[model samples]
Target: MSDRDASTPRVILARHGETEWTINGRYTGITELELTPRGEQQVLSTGKLLVGTGKLIDPVQLERVFVSPRRRARKTFELLFGTESELAALNKVEFTEDIAEWGYGAYEGLFGEEIVARRNEQGLDTERPWDIWKDGCEGGESSEQATQRLDSLINRIRDIQRPYMHGEKPVDIVLVAHGHILRAFAKRWLGVPMGSPLAMMLPPGAIGVLSYEEHDINAPAFLVGIALPLEEK
Candidate 1:
């Protein structure tokens, strides 16, 4: 791990490529849908832009990768890295249920408006439109549950990073999953409340970067953008 530079460790949150459900505004939880034809192209282009030896996410510096087990997520991981056999060589990739898409249960595959209508008919969220962050999904994973699992992942990442952050060996972690969970993960990373109104977006195949502020473990923050660390040939 001696290849690290003076900068702090980084965590890359990558949402999977477009899907039928995503384009149609469906809840898309636990349905195991495939990415659309354009989804594959989207991820390929992203890999070209953001992943490489000197790119934003240099794979050699990656300490660990956490991917959701859903097909769309797996496909994105595969597109970003390689096939299953190729990924085995990296020894840092883990496809886990902990990062799976938020389970919508009865609300799975329903559009937002449709979910709101049904919830209203059921005498739920009657006063206000259904907000997944606030009301959560009926018979599905709750905001608290999302907080618990995401916090566990964040702690695990911190454990891996805390001891080595200042060392010469830099470290990075990658999280590939669906829209809602990744957004929730970002909130949890900063110790934010899961039920807080989230006004962020990570469109398909988009990547968001996160890092500790001022090399302090307690001060996590979003790295929205920065000038490229370019070097002359």
Candidate 2:
């Protein structure tokens, strides 16, 4: 257990690059999709901005990297981190289903409008708009289920950093996953309920930072920064 600085350990949540379904605004949960050409380029650009010496994220300070089991997320990690040789030399990367995209289930591969129309036809509570956070997928995880799993993951992360909590060493972790799940993770990090009306938009390949306040490990965590695409900047 290395000694960590008083600063709360940080977690960098990176959403995977664009995919065919992402470009089309379709539900791609649990679907194996590759990054588009533009997606690949954009993520590469982000890597230059966020990773490396004096960058927002210092690669040498990273303790561990967690990635979604999905190919898109894995590919994004590779692109942002380094080449094969470079990645192999750094901290080991672990792929976990815990960070995978939300399970869309019956609503998989459908556009937002399509999901609402289908739900109406099936008479599955169509009185209101289809809000995944509130309604969840008919055959997928509910808000409770998602929150439970994410909370479990968060606890694991905190445990990993416990040994380094009071030291000067950096104990940062990186999560490469999907948009919805990462967004939800950020909210849960702040101890916010899943049903809360928190409007957070993480574009493809964007990086969102989470850390504690006042350099206190036990302090409430909050978003420190969100790195947008180079073009957007």
Candidate 3:
């Protein structure tokens, strides 16, 4: 069922490491936060794993790289691939808010346990059967807004792919971003309905590969694999 030929491009998604909020299950949005010590190790392990995978972008063949504007994501890109001169000499990396994490609004610092308790006390289990992308953020983004943002970002990637089929150079694109947004991107890539919350669930410091096979322009994107190399012992 391979639709991609040799012409279609591949996308590698890198999820940023654990911030304090992530470790505590807080709904982190665009708010900038540094990775915790554990988070830093997780990211380092990812970089080490990537190097071992032999997926290093060959300076000659490497095309473009993109990172979410959030500090955690941006730092992951810089650390994993090396800073400005390092990546630029090997490949081009750009920062774009389009790939930022889901905007959580009022839920920014609350974990699942906290959310559940708060809802319970209010006599309304607002988060029951909770699906992040399908829930309202109160002072933040609605599920609709999250879906729309993912859709727009995916569309941007698609536009880049169009020209790639007609002899334009094939670009190996890498995106450094958050777990929730990347999961949504995976859904959109495969044409899955936006509400399918389980399309993909990535852990902090995970690496996911999305590639086309057999050059089928209409073929759905595939999730080659998602690896979290630095989980706790």
Model 3 weakest lDDT span, ten residues long: 52-61
Q: Rank the candidates by TM-score, best first.
A: 1, 2, 3
- lDDT per residue (tens digit) for residues 130-178 in model 1: 7778667899988888888888989899999897666557678999998
Give a tens-digit lDDT track for model 3, residues 33-148. 99988888898887866643234433333467788988898788776866654666644767887788777776678877777676567676554655556666667777677677
Please list the C-alpha lDDT of all candidates, in the order they appear: 0.84, 0.82, 0.71
The number of the candidate with the highest TM-score is 1
**How do the predictions measure up, each by TM-score?**
0.93, 0.88, 0.81
Clashing pairs in 1: 1-169, 4-170
- How many backbone clashes does every candidate have? 2, 6, 10
Query: Candidate 2 residues 1-233, lDDT tens each?
Result: 22223355788889989999999999999889999999998799999877876566777667788899999998998899776625456645778988889988988999988988998888877576767888788899898889999999999888777766654667889999999999999888888998888998899989888876655556646554444323423
